[model samples]
Target chain A: MTLLQVAAFTSDFPDDMVEDEHDIIQFGGKGVSEAIGAILSGLGYSVGELDYQGERGWEFSAGAEGQQIWLLLSDLGDYLMLQVEDPSFMGLRPKYRQFREHFLSGLTDALNRDGRFHDLLWFAAVGDPFGFPDPAGEGGRRPAPQAWRWS
Target chain B: MASPPLQSRARVVTKSYRPMRGIEVVGPLARPEYESPSDIAAKARSAAAAYVDRHPEHRSKAMMAANIAGAGAGVVRGGYHMAKGLVDAAAFVQRAANPLPDVLLGRKTAGQQTIDLAGAIGDYVIEGRADPSRLGRDAKQAVANAKADLFPSATPVAANTADELARRFSIGMNQGELGANVASLAVGGPLAKAVGKAGEVMALQRFPAARYIAQGYSPEAAAYLAEPYSGMGSHWVPRRTKPPSWFVDSDYNVLKPRGITRGEMYELHARVDPKFSTARLPPRFADRSWRFEKSGLRRHGPLAQVWHGMPGATKAKGGGSLAAFGSGAHQLGEEGYQ
Candidate 1:
């Protein structure tokens, strides 16, 4: 099978109202989208389309062909839809089990590649998890894109 | 019978005499024959097999067989690199698990120093030059946070004293609470507003931790400090809180005092820019100028020479060539009336 370079990118974070931990809101949440993007890119997919929709966003195809991969870079701490990309690629709903499993495996697999795909960064504003908060009260995190190769 | 005996004796004596004059003995001196090609090949195989037999459980036998087999297989040799890679992988894994204690110690000390310095400065800012107690909870927390940033696993505690606080005054201080004060800063305000400010402080604090990490500190150390400041609304308590960005920003004025502009902080990491131009002046003074002269001009000689001409008027052409200038001339008779 042909391996195609693909990626999924978004800047959405969970709305302040969304309290459910299981919700896979595309761009909503913490570093999930960004993490997914990083994981996919690491797996040899070029994350191409990432558009923002205020509190929500979407990404096009992610991950490479002939490889178990789907990278979704959201604000939810670097999620990797790996070993299977059906839900992530199609932007499906509620990944209760698949999300958690894929996240761990994809993260490990990316880390185990030729380069450290796990080296992808997550930035939170100071009050945020790993970054600083918006000083202007825009309710958005600053995007500091640091690139990494897959391991 | 008597005549036959005499003739026999005479014949025996004649035969004995002939042998004594001409007899020569030969020794075995002929060269040995050479062996066949099959014999040499069989010897090599035997040697190899014997070596393997001696080490029955070792994989070296297989490796040897593989190496020998490879000779005619047309693959380029990579045994050395492969072996080195194996060694490196083993070493990397080992190192990842067991970090050097000495390195960790140094990192911790540096982090502590940073906290101490930041606290002292913060103290001076809050309580005037004399009131030693001015480095308040926020300042105390800043030191702790800075220390946390430096040493990820442990919290930095302050040793409050006149001398320790004095040193930080020298380093300079920017007024305001540290990233650690975020929990206290977040009030009963709407969740949307609280989260934003919280994230900002976290980002600002990440810089120094990032700096430390870049300087060989572990991410674990940075994370330890970041943990206290990362609490969300429900997670945080009131005692650790400080004023919001609006009140704090206006009250302390972070820009005027700290000298910690984003640009400056970024430059501190990149270690470049026009501000660093001051460092370039020293090397510019080359050997042409005397050390004393350079020192006299405060080592601004090169710049001075380049920008403005030399201190005094220069000598004119051939005004005093070494041949005729200030030297006791060596006299010689002209070649006898050339």
Candidate 2:
């Protein structure tokens, strides 16, 4: 099984905001959860409230013809984590990989167009167990695949 | 003429001296039974002065030795003072940064107050040795000054409201719980194995009757309980003894459990009391709040729960059963029951 986690600090965004201990990001008098929901909805994904493993967050599901995708988002104080998992029992690894790549690229593009988000400071991914690359870097437009790929 | 001299000597009244054995004795002198106090004192003074004059080097050596010993003692006393002061200073800073329960309980924190007391006692001894006249005054002043320096602002802020005290108590409780959790997690694997091994060894060391029970020996005829038995023809059968309870199953080779290993007990303990768990970020990550922000990511699902529970996740935050266990254990640890 593969697990993916993507986190970005709210403080790094151009919007002067802070996340409380409850992982609720407050910016422009609107919660980051609401913003994420809006963003996911605008991207043509079906977004809904998710309670996965007793963790409160948002779930995004979408499909185009044959390919289906699922994404889970949870708020961590000062950061947001998006977890992608394969719901189908079909042992297809490449499908999850492709979905992660497309989702990350689309999310990055959306954030860029939002104007409020200044940059993505860090990005990280893990394919297998203990597969984690270093996620340290300065603010930038979008992180290279090499930056988040585990060696 | 000799006879006339002897007669005259025998007369004695006219002679003032006597000759005997080549020595001449003068007339009898007046002898006092005891010397006067003044005379004795004078004689003693003169004798002492003469002795000192004769052994000037000895006097100087004694004086130098006394001075050196005194200086060495002073240096040792000073070193003690400095060391105690530094320790007390460090304790003071630690107590200030993280006020312990003892402070709120209206008691001095452990180790710190004892050190301060020792320092005070040392000061008293030093003062007494250096100057007995100023002993009380000097010792009291030094102690007061040291106390002031070390315990400045240590007075428990009287919590006017119960809510305030409760809040402080909660904060301290949470910190302690976190620390306990971190410690437990750090040593859980080894500790669990050790405990399991110890239990097995204890079971093995029991009396033969109990040991037999632990080895899964069933009660049958006393004759059949022997170590070796001639079964069927000439084939001897060994005792059908089962593995000890410490074994995962009847198989003596496999010590670890197939379903739940010994380490799982420790994980359970951590879940029961996260204070006993030591799972935490490294010091570098923990020290900086920003690092938590930048690196806040975790796994999910039942497999993730088996791997490790997230540190700060709880039931309120929608964590699973592990989180609930953590929360309950944290409360127990905080309440001093765990």
Candidate 3:
């Protein structure tokens, strides 16, 4: 089992703040998710409108080429279940899907622009397994997802 | 000529090349206008001093800030690179279109796992996460993601090791500088090790070179030796020593001593060794003297030599030697030697 954890603060926070904690927008809060979604769209990953199921979480899937990415967003943050045609290559991460999506999409964009033939072929998958669950499905925290920003 | 009076073992030592004739000249061949040690030192020092005098406090602060900013930029760049690598690796797996997904599902080898992980790490470095101490939970988690991206057993042993070490060394380094330094070292270290290992791998394949080079050598060496050198573009030699000096350092005596002043030494050092020149502060006065040892000054090539004169140099350039060096530095850069 592999575990990764991350703590982050929102970027470009407003300079003028005189109110409470809720007004400031903590890192893992709602504003962050919206920002993450926008960044994802900017990177070419289309996120379907999310639907909340009871108290469990929100579910949605983004698709590109032949792959479909299923994600879950809850109070904890976002979760991503990445799937390709290959059954063995399935990947799941908790509460960092926003970063993961952005990272993958940004990478694809960069590679395409870097000289498509060699660059695209060079980076097509996660180089190493980021996190995996144990037989009991109870392992350490999964790695926080990452995002790429060109500007 | 009377063979240049070479009578002292203490001064001149035997060497393969002919003695440097230009060293004995009173004035620099590059700068015919300036003619003495005092002249060169004064010119360089005054130029440097002017700038120093103007910004009594901001100079050092600016330098430190620039260095830190540079380091931070490196880290950001590295992080971005790693993120891009992850995408590539994921794409590679998808394109393989392999039917053995079930067969290889969780049994991936260390090599299989690390290739993409390396890329992800590259992104981390590029994105300005270079400083280990400054890494937030998000950065740590990003590093941990390598385990899932690469290893089937989900082991992040290698990635974690690399991340931890990089972080430790870069604790206080600027994010960019830290990232760049770590990235260079990381990339270079692996390349060096691989190159070392390749020589051995080629030798084991029973290649032709194995006959002599691999004699009594280990398996690794033999393998690398066996491979033909044709495909290997260029041999990369590890940097084992300081880079060669790109400037010439020569000293001259002051026929007439002048009043010691600030920035005079810096100007001289800048003239002669601009490539590696810097002014050193003295116990009595931070800026004084012609030699780097005395003034604690250094200059990059060409500039260092240019800054090697005295009184005339200081007086001609105006009151501030610091600004003189900074202002004409670009020109010195143009005529710099290797």
Candidate 4:
């Protein structure tokens, strides 16, 4: 089994943009559903609209193809969690790779447009989950991620 | 050329790359002439200061009025969040326990139940923090927008309408800047109220991002730091319990900086005597960064959604409020502390 290669970035996207309070983004209320919907729409995925339906709980879901990628505000309001199935087989790879670049660049650009989120840090994490038991091993410790931001 | 900023103790950090092409014709693009958020936020305060500078009497009046308005809005919003939280909690529990009547009944969706649960606690949690304690941006916007709202309409025609007889003699009731606000109050009051009320929702629902981009962030960060505007909504997380097959252990040189520094503010460099790599995955799939690759999560062993209309409906409802507020708080900064 190979190690999990994780890259994560941090910015100052506002919490008001989350509409966890209401089923719909309320008037004068901060919620990012609409903003997220706009991004998915830009990516050629016809983002779903909200109604009194089974899919309501999902803040945003872009399953345009059979790809299993979902963006949701977790029960914890901390990080906007992206739950992704392996895109290689979920959709065509080269194309999936394209989806990633346009999506990330567009997203970070759009969010950064608000101007509050800065010092955009990306963490390229490399850590092994499996290692023989040993006392002085770094494996027992949480992966101390190294991050650098794009200016 | 500068390399994209790289930081890794593990050796052989593969260089970053993009596909020769993309699925969509539109490649990565930047907004033309984009102004950063901080820049947009500064505009309002500067404009307000200029306006106040020009009119000292109005400055005193505006400042005094602003303090009252700011404190009032804070207290009101604070209370609203608290009361709303409690109400949401009750609704969450009520619907979560019995969801059968959701279709035209007392029922709420399972997710709704969870939301209300968190909202209730969140409301109380955020109450003490709601007021915009000296939030400069919003306050400046208020003044600028207020002037913008009242000025254009306060023309000679408006003066005529307000003081028609006085206007007939070419002398009108112009009571300085205060008069415009008063005129808007007495004349535009009922009709404007109706129109403003009708348009409030439509106006608010539109242009949030544009407005934020054009102007700035909410004071939620100032009073309580209730936000982290990170544009990470589309990031990939490892969903599979296992890594993909291609992940391979590899090696490369690790760069280390010698801690000892001379007074010239320069640090000596050192390299890891031997290089090491945690593992290597194909570069094309690097963006998949974090993964418990599904290769997908399906229990083909067989499972069924027995009752309550949806399978995880009950859990969604049960977990509604504050079981966990925001997901990625384990992150290094307040970025995850929604």
Candidate 5:
């Protein structure tokens, strides 16, 4: 069996948006929250929040559809970043592409509709869950692409 | 018969005697001696096990003692950091929950102190004068946010004092209206926005590319190069909102008021234009793909797990280095570039 792979990337939130809890059309706009919600709904994944256990700050997460899609809202309050969960990549390549599309493209479509988040620079990289080593290694992260393109 | 009686008298003889010497005793669980059997090591282990069986309480007591001793030593060695983390946590909650007590006590929270220190340093770095917003955080308005958050009953006490002195000092205006203060901060929000325009205007002029970033321009788009701000400043908030590109995603500098971030330092150094130089750069800057985070910057990728986790001297070193990089980035952009 091959290593289970997951799509992972970092997104930046400008300073005004980083710590915002309230204010619409302003920093921490309602649009940002709605965009995330929309992405979950469109992808057919349930809404979730990270427990953080003994740690500080809020880190929300949701991985549903039998692990077809998953996401973790960054815990660090200073910067807003996102992590998609590890889905088993032992399946066919088309299945892998479908999982990747659900979030990145789903998010892009949502942002286009709301027109709030812009240039949401998503990048490419894959990792194995359960710490399985990858065969390709450093050669996998090539410099040719800066951001991920979606349909 | 006569000869036999003489012989019996001569038969009595005396014998000298000495007591056996005591063997020197050794300490418990130390060297031991056993019978002629060869497996003394195994026998000794069994004997030790038997002793514990007889004194089960001693085993537990010994374990408790060892654990306590280890914890005490840990506290002694790393206690200062532990103590600070605890204090910061308390202040963090208290300041968030109800800052009045902290302010009345004349104590500034860690974040505020960090902001002030950054401003003090900026005096030497940011065009000779630190931005006032960065230098002095107004204490009163900040304190007012907690009224409904922690103790909603204190709503009557929260108010807005329009006087400049209270706004500047964030002191003594502890007696204000919550609704009014929130309102004033909003409609009069222009007041907060108005103070730093000149310095910010200078910053914007120094780099118009900021406008593109502000508008969420795609670097992939042909027009990504920064343009002069023909657009009005009314809605476009700059510099304060987003950071420039050179910043590592995980290494937040208190001086710059940005967050922490990534990279294999050697990997990042390879990407930078050799002619465009800066000091104290992490060998690599975190590309967008690096994502997972714990206490520090983490990629959690198959390979991108380089985060500077230790916080004391190492984090301080990061803060100082990042501060220098802030200046270096400004220099590279402003004084002409290749």
Candidate 6:
């Protein structure tokens, strides 16, 4: 599994919203991907086509502030985990708070309308020092992300 | 003839042996044979055990003696603190009542007197004579609540007299007592456990004789025996409720009159900036989060020097180094503006 190195926000949906793995892969995963794409596009970032890997997960590439960024939306049971990968955007340490504010604000605004996004059971911004270690020790000089749960 | 001769010879030999010049008779068998060190130690231990056994009340009597001594010491210390607190309180009231005499006497400046008064009040509060928890509650609201509870329909400000001060003080004291009682009851279980642990540590450190006795029994049994003496001192000390962050931020200063409400400020902020809205703010802002932010500034800014000088304020929450405060302030400012 890739270590999510940037600031990520996780929102767990109610059991009724996505009951099984199939539902998560089809409805929940697609919804999160589309919402993120729309948010990025609205913010003047050019979003690429959504790449779906069936039950595996889905992801998309986007260009924001003249930097290529990847949005990986994955399913973990009944929740959607959003991780941003910006190769040229530097480490998450310097821009943690900014990224958190921007991501939560955009996602909240996009989802919290007409009670359509009311299925959100919990929402939290994971702090810097994210992701698991590279088992092969190939990711050189990368700082291990610390787990932070900001409610 | 032979029997008669043998008897005569025995009598003659006995008489002659008494006059032998080179032979010496030993006295008391030469102090008996010297015993080994281990045998001597065993004998001593057995003697002690036997003596203790003979006087079954010895252990209880020793424990009682220790308890009495400890209790006496606790009482003395408690009384000292209580008296000191009373003196400080009296000094504070005197200065607060009339500041001109001290100023004219050139003993203390107005600022010095104010600092002293604050310190005295702090000592009083820390001594548990006053409720430190009540500092965070709106002052006006507290006074109103106290009035409603004690003297219904009587406003504290209506009478600007000594009697009014007395009445308000009485009400506050009652509230403080109630708060202390409630707090004690709430934390009774955990407090007892903590006290027990502390007592165990104290007993191990202070009593070598008890430890020797304890070696003869199981650890659990020994702990039970030493438990009573462990908490003797703590029993006399009052449980302290931590003062609120705002109180610490106020420079160990007395509570001030609140001028504005968070809601009103939120409304004002909304009106000033078109982009500003309550929806954009974190949910906690609706509650006491604004006060936390304000307090954070004092902890993380120029006001920190004053807080650091306070007795226990520096150890309290948000009372960190200047660099930490800078980081906290930056985070708070970012959230506040957002």
Indicate which candidate wins on TM-score.
2
> Tens digits of per-residue lDDT for model 2 on B1-338?
11122222222321111121222333332222123422432332233333334545434332222222222222333333334456757866777666676566666554555466578779878878888878777567766543432231323432332222222322222222233334336674344334334433432222112222112222111111212311111000111122344432223221122333212322332332211211111112221111211222322223333223322322235447656665565554434321
Q: What total of clashing residue pairs does each candidate reach?
A: 69, 13, 151, 30, 19, 5
- Model 1 Cα RMSD, 1 decimal: 42.3
For every model shown, what is its TM-score relative to the native structure?
Answer: 0.14, 0.28, 0.17, 0.22, 0.23, 0.21
Real interface contacts reproduced by model 1, as a fraction: 0.00
- Clashing residue pairs for model 6: A3-A131, A129-A145, A129-A146, A130-A145, B300-B325
| Tens-place lDDT digits, model 2, residues A1-151 | 3333544434342322344542313322125545665786788766555322112234455544355555544443334444444553632567756765576567667766676554443344443122222233234324655334321
lDDT of 1 by residue, A1-151 (tens): 1111222223233332232342222234324445556666775665645433211123334434322223322232222211122332433333424443444446446545524233332322232221122111232223333212233
Chain A TM-scores, one per candidate? 0.28, 0.52, 0.36, 0.45, 0.47, 0.49
The candidate, 1 or 4, that scores higher on TM-score is 4
lDDT of 3 by residue, B210-264 (tens): 2212123232222233333211110011011112333111112121123222223
- C-alpha lDDT of all candidate models, in order: 0.29, 0.36, 0.32, 0.30, 0.31, 0.37
C-alpha positional error of residue A104 in candidate 4 after TM-score superposition, expressed in Å: 2.4
How does model 3 fare in lDDT? Answer: 0.32
Best by DockQ: 5
Which prediction has the highest lDDT against the true structure? 6
lDDT of 6 by residue, B212-306 (tens): 23234322222223332211011001111225655433423321113322223322222222211211112212221111111111121223222
Writing each residue's lDDT as its tens digit, candidate 5 over B1-338 gives 11122112112110001101121222331232222222322232233233334545544332222222222222222223334446756866767677676567766644565566577566545743445463334334444454422232443422322121112111111111222234335664343233223323443343332222223323211022222112111111112224554432223311111121112221122122110011111112222212112112212222111121222233466687754654555454333322
Q: In order, what fnat does every candidate score?
A: 0.00, 0.00, 0.00, 0.00, 0.00, 0.00
- Candidate 6: residue B140 lDDT (0-100): 59
> Where is the poorest 10-residue window by lDDT in model 4 chain A?
A128-137
Q: Point out the higher-scoring one by DockQ: 2 or 5.
A: 5
Model 6 docking category: incorrect
What candidate 1 gets wrong by more than 4 Å, as runs, is A1-46, A49-93, A96-105, A116-126, A129-151, B1-338
lDDT string for model 3 (A63-86, tens) is 555445554332321121111111
> Which parts of model 5 have CA positions greater than 4 angstroms off?
A1-35, A50-65, A75-79, A88-97, A126-144, B1-338
The digit string of per-residue lDDT tens for model 4 on B1-338 reads 22111122111111111111111112222121223422332343334334445545544333332222222222323233334546756865776676776745544466664565577667655753675553555567666544432333333432322122112111110112133234345674344334333333232232122122112222211111112221111101121223343421101111111221110000001000000111111122212111112111111110110111111323355474412332222121122112
